[model samples]
Target: MNKTTWAMVTFSVGLGLSACGEEAGGPTVEQVAKAYEMYMNVNLATELGQRIEVRGWEDFKPGCKSSGPERVKCITGGKVELMGFQGGEQTVPKPVSVPAEFDLEFEKRENTWVPVRAQKK
Candidate 1:
């Protein structure tokens, strides 16, 4: 077979295998949001404690706040900033933001709302 034909065959096989091997109990938006929150809590707590231990002051803070719903905007060290969602009743819109944190960048994967791999921020 020609190179193009062989490449197509390989691509097809890979796609089929990946689809078949998809993990069970696939992650959901709710799960990802919760994981994100847990990660943030732990990481931020550690950072806060570390600064206190090293600098002898708890003045340092992670400037962030919940913008209603499951959304949060965090600005860290005046450089990096992250926006995330943790599915909840407060999510924007009346019914609820099903795909809560739906279109947000730090949320999309392959154009679909997929569970975050980091399991934490």
Candidate 2:
């Protein structure tokens, strides 16, 4: 092969190898967990005067090994607190606490992680 062609081939191979070694561009396991916790807390507080307090997370997987880049799933645990009404005509309800689990799925689109599904388990 010509010197110019050989140089181009070498450069292409190097670039491909570098790209392969790089990590995927998307939210990490911790970031995804934090976002999910925040979403649950905000929605619950808005709708039910309650919020979920995340104590910790476990069984977190950043990417789906079997399904490849298209799907990722994470699981977490927390406690949900049912807040009492403050300064409302209705009587204040007693606060209730419950243990909760979350199952979350995320998809990769154009190098970004998009939440595809979320469930309370």
Number of clashes recorded per candidate: 1, 0
Across 4-110, the per-residue lDDT of candidate 1 in tens digits comes to 22111111112221111122222232333333333443444234432111111122122333333333332222111233233322222322211112121122233
Clashing pairs in 2: none
Error of 1 at 82 (Å): 10
Per-residue lDDT of 27 in model 2: 46
The most accurate candidate by TM-score is 2
Local accuracy of candidate 2 as per-residue lDDT tens digits, 1-121? 2212211111111222121112444345455545455556544543665444433434433332223556556454444443334334333445355554556555666544555555667
TM-score of 1: 0.23
Candidate 1 worst ten-residue window by lDDT? 51-60
